[model samples]
Target: MNHQGWGAPPDDKGATPFAYPEQPVGGFPGAAPGVPFGSEPGMPQPWNVTDSFAFAWNRIKADPGTIIGTMLLGYFISNLPSTIARFIPSDEPSDETSLIVTIVLALLGGLFSTFMMGGMTLFTLNVARGSFYRLNDIFQGGPFFLSILGANLLIGLGVMFGTMLLIVPGIIIALGLCLTTLIIVDRRCGAIEALQQSWRLMNGHKLNVFLWWLMAAVVSLVGILACCIGTIVTAPLLQIAFAFVYLKISGQTTADSVGA
Candidate 1:
């Protein structure tokens, strides 16, 4: 409850021992504590994904409300169209109406997803850089929405298209484009550029990222198991963890960490 603000609202126990240096925004929580002794200060310096979980968790604890609230809202909106479509029984056996409903639902879902992801990407990017944001940050993604949507669409197409060829190729395509959104958010690049960059960045690192994903997935299942509220914490933590991955692979550094 004593957010120093949100590491689940900052406590002596949870404030990241590591520092993410940023100027305290006028209305947000005061600046984070100074960098811990071992803090590095340069690019390509990878933060350990596993160890950074504590830090990421602390970040979530700092502002669980905004983060969780935004997530819940996104979840609702994204699923609402489908939920509605499901209830709308096809009038005739032709199924054209049902097909239209399905198409509309898919489009709505895509829009909601783009909006949510843009916000999440922005949120994670801010946190990784040691900045705090207001709840509105969730909607702030509108600016990047187009790029995020396009990136996702393209990545999906690549994966699906490849899957049409072979399951193995599809899997490969998926892993390769995993970092596409991050690239778009950070570099503010176009979808194709981001996908290309993600593929390149993931080069020689897909296996490690996959391992990290598996580990996070297990943790995620734990949250899902907890009647899903646990996801309020785990979901953001996963995002932050991947942010670290992107930062490391791209040779970007947080406020204090540097590459050794």
Candidate 2:
């Protein structure tokens, strides 16, 4: 497979027809021919959740090692801050010092988790598009760091404000902006643009996306009920499913059309 640089998508001047501007570094996949942007002939009129989930399942089953391993590694590294904070030597530290350290660690953990989410999005997008992916693709989120971080902040504030107005608004905002990260990573757009695009994308499809989220929540709850070990499986499954949903909703060339 032909591989491009791992950082960011190539600039528009250098991008091939198959790639996005700034190469929206989701994963390091070689450019393959595909429908041009804005031309998703196979785009679903009303995407099927079952189909998305099935595509995710098939992809996972096809190569559990790369898919699961990359996700696991990203999760592990992202949580390292909290893991280390738990082991901090509390004996020698004053209460205030300990509290400060805990706050710092908590902040770091959130940032790491957000950063890893972007990386994972990249990897998952590769899978959704039937592009070659590697375990290291999870570390190529640096190019998307600012976009992801900004979007997160904006989404968080929007959700928080909406919650203050009423509980329903908060839920709506959360669902609407859920695809912000994927938009930013996939389109190389800034935070505001991605958030706007995501909001617009869900204009008439909120119910469908909500149902998908509900299904994911149930699966995750079941995984938790199954002694937490099941999360190791459910987590990656849902992640891949989400990528498929994003690709279909955004009218991009999905895994289903790779060789067609």
Candidate 3:
């Protein structure tokens, strides 16, 4: 359980302790020897879409309780506002008070949803790195709240503006910024800094990310077809897969790379 360089070596059970950095850095600090940093902005780096999913699947199998339990709790709590809104009386369309309540609840849901996303992003990063994680890790994103919120807000506005110009720009912006929240939490960077870093990190890999996302979406759809219950597995699989890809592409030490 002793923290080594970036994280402790895997114990007998193949689990490492979670060790987040206290001070923010430009990227994941303390790279292990022989691990190459990612390519320059214009250079293409090899990426395997399936490998990321395989890594995620392995981790989920190793710790389904923490993975699935955290996801479920975050999902439930984030949606509470909307869930409660459904039970409120709404028989009249012109009810100003009811309308105001609905708007407020929706806003609350969105705020909680953003925070949960940040918390889950951090938790999943730990999972991807093969570190220990617990259900409470889902609520550990408070420290990065301002940065996360700012990054998300900027991304939303940029994407919206890009979409107004053309749909492709919006998609491109989204792909480029997909890892902003992760970067903010992982590197302790500000919103604009995280956005720029993500954009640079994703260089030459956006297509691969998009393709991987498409595959994940298909997997989720299949799970839904089997019955929504299957999402418990598929959902965490997606989260871990995303974290794995981010670690791999950004040259951070992952569970798979720890021993090697």
| Model 2 weakest 10-residue run by lDDT | 1-10
Query: Across residues 1-260, which tens digit of lDDT does each residue of candidate 2 receive?
Result: 11122233345533333332244433335433563322322444447778877888888888888788889899999999999899877776667888898999999998898778777888888788787777767876765666778778888899999999999999999999988888776666667777887898777778889899989999899999999998888889998899888877876767777761
* Full candidate order by TM-score, most accurate first: 2, 3, 1
Worst lDDT 10-window in candidate 3:
1-10
Which segments of model 1 are wrong by more than 4 Å?
1-43, 89-99, 164-166, 255-260
Model 3 lDDT tens row, 1-260 = 12122211222322313323332323333333433222222333355889888988888888788788888888898899999999889879999999999999999988888778767887787777765567777876665566777777889999999999999999999999998887776665567777888999888889999999899989899879887888888888888898878877776667777751
Candidate 3 ranges with C-alpha deviation above 4 Å = 1-45
Model 1 scores a TM of 0.72
The TM-score, computed over Cα atoms with residue i paired to residue i, of candidate 3 is 0.82
Which candidate comes out best when scored by TM-score?
A: 2
List RMSD in Å for every model shown: 10.8, 5.8, 8.1
The candidate, 1 or 2, that scores higher on lDDT is: 2
lDDT of 1 by residue, 150-243 (tens): 6776778888999999998988889899987876656545666677777887787777777887889899999999999888778778887777
What is the model-wide C-alpha lDDT for candidate 2? Answer: 0.75
How do the candidates rank by lDDT, highest first? 2, 3, 1
What TM-scores do the predictions have?
0.72, 0.84, 0.82
